[model samples]
Target: MSRYFLIRIGQSLLAIWGIVTIVFVVTRMLGDPAVLLLPLGTPDSQIQELRSSLGLERPMIVQYLDFLRHAAVGDFGLSYQSFRPAMEVVLERMPATAILTASSLALGAVLGAATGFAAALARGRFLEFVVMCLALAGQATPVFWLGILLVLFFAVELGWFPTGGWDGPASLVLPTMALGIFVAANITRLFRSSMIETLSEDYIRTARAKGLMPRTIFMVHAARNALIPVVTMLALLAAELLGGSAVTETVFSWPGVGRLLVQAIDSKDFPVIQAGVFLIATIFVGVNFLVDLLYTLLDPRIRLGR
Candidate 1:
């Protein structure tokens, strides 16, 4: 188990390094942010001065090394726009993002699991058909459109929730529903399929033949086996939710990292952009690591094989 954990950690570190390198290269390729930061028709000398001040005058390799060095200590340089530490700016908005992410994830997971479990249990019945139809509609709907419609109905027409901005719990409902519905739909499909396959396995039949209660055979035997793939899907879904939050946040005007990232991109704020991407990438890698650890716990064979 220790060896497995070490290998996963090593892989995660390598992946983060690659993400940082990619973000650095790509942000630089978007043109000099110093130019964007300056006024129209700024003199070349003034631009050069600003560039030098921001360390753009340094060689690419030197800047990259500096970025890596500082990032190792949780520094991501100063934002081109705010002049504050880049990570500081990112962290300031993290709470909102974290709340939105957690709420959406929990809502989606519960809804998906319950719906999927019901569908699996009632396999060919009307309930299964209704659940599948709802899942299909959710998957087909675009998040942005859904968010807008939700705002229109709940906020504008009914006035049950705020249209945009983060103020209180009421502000969260629409965005959470918009983000979670898609996740729930995908998870429902995956879980339903996995459950069906698991139910057909010989071990499930053996449990049933052994005269175990139907609930035990279904929950303990079948559900446990079915969850392995769902666990992996959930990890990937977390990363997707973080990335997808940008669109939802934009639509809802939520004061989260996603909205911050969009604002930075629009203003060509390279430092903030790099920091945001790096942070999201780090979260993705971290979630995958946890999922790997969960795999061993869920099925001891995974640890034994390693």
Candidate 2:
């Protein structure tokens, strides 16, 4: 088990390195930051001076190596926009993003698992049809569009909640829903299928034959196995939510790491952008690592160190 964990840790570190490198290279490709940073009509001399100061004047290979060196020690320099440590700025927004991610995941996983299990049991019934249709619609809708629609209806027209801002609990609703609805829809489909398959297995039939209560047979024998796939899906869903939060937060004006990254990109804030990507990637990899540990609990037959 220790060896397996070490191997996974190495792979995760490698993945983070790859993601950071790709983002670093791609960000440079979006054009020189010095040009975007300086005011329009600024003198070329000033722009050149800024570039030199920022080390943008260096060769790309040199800059990348320097970046990697500092990044290993949790330094990404200062934000071009805020003139503060980039990681600090990103971390300040971390709690907000953490709230959003947790709320969204909880909403999605609980609702999806329940609805999916119910749908599986109610297969061939009207309830199943309704759930499936809603799931389809949820999956089909884009996060940004849903956020807009939610803002329009729930905030603009009805005034049930604030359209944007992170004032209190009410502010979290729209963005969470926008990010979570898709997660729920996907999980619903996957879980429903897994449940149906699990229910048909020989062990399930044996439990049924042993005079186990119907509820016990379903909950104990079927639900646990069905949950394994949902657990895997949840890890992937978390990554999607992190990605989608950028759009959702922008639309809703929710202050989060996602929104911070967008602002960094708009202002050509390279350090903040790099820092944000690194933080998000690290969180994602960590989540996947935890999910790997969870597999043992979900399915005892599976061993980790094999």
Candidate 3:
């Protein structure tokens, strides 16, 4: 078990390093932000001075090595725009992103589980067909488009909720729905499939033959077994939700780290961009690691194998 945990931790750290390295390289390739910081007709000498001050004049390899060294200690440098510590800016927005991620996950999981169970129980019926169709449509739809439609209908046409902002819980409704719809659709399909398989197993048949009620057979026997795979899916879904929030946050103008990253990209703010990507990658990787540990509790085979 100790070895298993060590391996998982090593793998997660490697994944974070790879992702952060990629983002660091990509952000640098987006052009020198120092040039953008100056006036349109600023002297070339002044621009060069600015670049030198910002340390962009250094060789790419040297810059990358320096970044990695500082990053190892959680120092991601300063935000070129806000002049604040880059990670500090990112962390300041973490609460909003965390709220959005948690709310969306909870909403999606509950809806998906309920609809999936219903679809499985009502297989070959109208409810099953309708649920499946909706799930497929939800899966196929792009999150940005969904967010726009939500804004159009709810915030524009009917005015039930605010279009964007972090004013209150009311402001969260649209973005949460936009980000969570795909999660719900995915879980619905997976849970429905698992439930169907569980229902077909001998234990379920025996329970039915022994005069077990429908609810009892499903809640006690089928749902519990069906949830094992879904637990894994939930972890993956959480990572997806966090990644997908970039588009959702941009579209809705939410002041989360995702939106901050978008702004950083537009301005080519290397520190903020790198910090944002690194922080998010670390979080999702850590979430997956924790979920893997949770799986051992759910299934003894995992610990035994370890």
Candidate 4:
């Protein structure tokens, strides 16, 4: 188990390195930072001075090394637009993104898992058909479009929720629902399929032959087996939730790391962009690692390598 954990940790480090190198190289290879940084009408000599001040005049290798050193110390530099440290801005906004991700995952998992289990047990019943239809519609629908429609219905027409902002708990409702519903839909499909498979296994039949109660069989035997795939999918989805937060946050004008990232991109703020990218990548790697560890805990065979 310890060895497996170390393996995951090593993989996470490699992922972080790959992300850092790619972002660093790609951003630097783009058009001159000075051209974007300086005033449009600034004299060429002044632009050169500005570049020198920002250490942009140095060779690419030296610049990358400096960035690495500063990044190691949490000095991700300052956003050109906000004139604040990139880390500071990201830190301030992170809670909103965290809240959004947590809410989406919690709601999606519970709802999806329950719906899936119920549908799978129903098999060929009307409820199963209806659940499948909803799943298809959800999978086909894009999140942004859903968000817009929800805002139009709930906020614009009914005025049950505010259209945008992270001003209060009430303002979080629409965006959370918009993001979570699609996630729930997908999870439902996964859970239903996994559960159906588990139910058909001979072990389930054995339990039934042993006179196990239906509820006991479901809660103890089938549910644990069904949850494995769900956990895997949930981990992968966490990365998406964090990365996709940008679109949801933008649509709702929520003060989150995603929105901050968009603002950085629009202004070509390298520091903020880099910080957000690194943070998002780290989250992906971190969650994936945690998932691997959890799998072993959930299934003894995993730890024992059965």
Which lDDT values do the candidates have, in the order given?
Answer: 0.88, 0.90, 0.88, 0.85
Judged by TM-score, which candidate is best? 2
Candidate 2 clashes between residue pairs 3 or more apart in a chain or in different chains? none
- Relative to the unseen true structure, what is the C-alpha lDDT of residue 166 in candidate 1, on a scale of 0 to 100? 76
The residue-by-residue lDDT of candidate 4 on 1-306, one tens digit each, is: 576667778888888878987888877765677788777898999989878877779998998998888877778887767779988878888888888988998889988998999899999999999998998898899888999999999999999999999668989898889878988998999999999999999999999999999999998999898889999999888786776488888999998888888887777778888888888888899888778778877776676323
Deviation of model 3 at 129, angstroms:
0.8
Number of backbone collisions per candidate, in order? 0, 0, 0, 0
Compute the lDDT of residue 273 as modeled in candidate 3.
90
| Distance from true location, Cα of 121 in model 3, Å | 1.0
For model 1, residues 53-101, the per-residue Cα lDDT tens digits are: 9999999999999989988987888888888999899989988888888
TM-score of 3: 0.94
Lowest summed lDDT window (length 10), candidate 1:
297-306
> How does residue 143 of candidate 3 score in lDDT?
90
Q: Report clash pairs, candidate 3.
A: none
- Per-residue lDDT of candidate 2, residues 1-306 (tens digit): 889989999999999999999999999977888888888999999999999999999999999999999999999999988889999999999888878888999999988999999999999999999999999999999889999999999999999999998879999998888888988999899999999999999999899889999999998889998999899999977865664378888999988888888888887899999999998898889989899899999899889987
* RMSD list, candidates in order: 1.5, 1.4, 1.8, 1.7
TM-score of each: 0.95, 0.96, 0.94, 0.94
Model 2, residue 212: C-alpha shift (Å): 0.7
Minimal lDDT window, size 10, model 3: 297-306
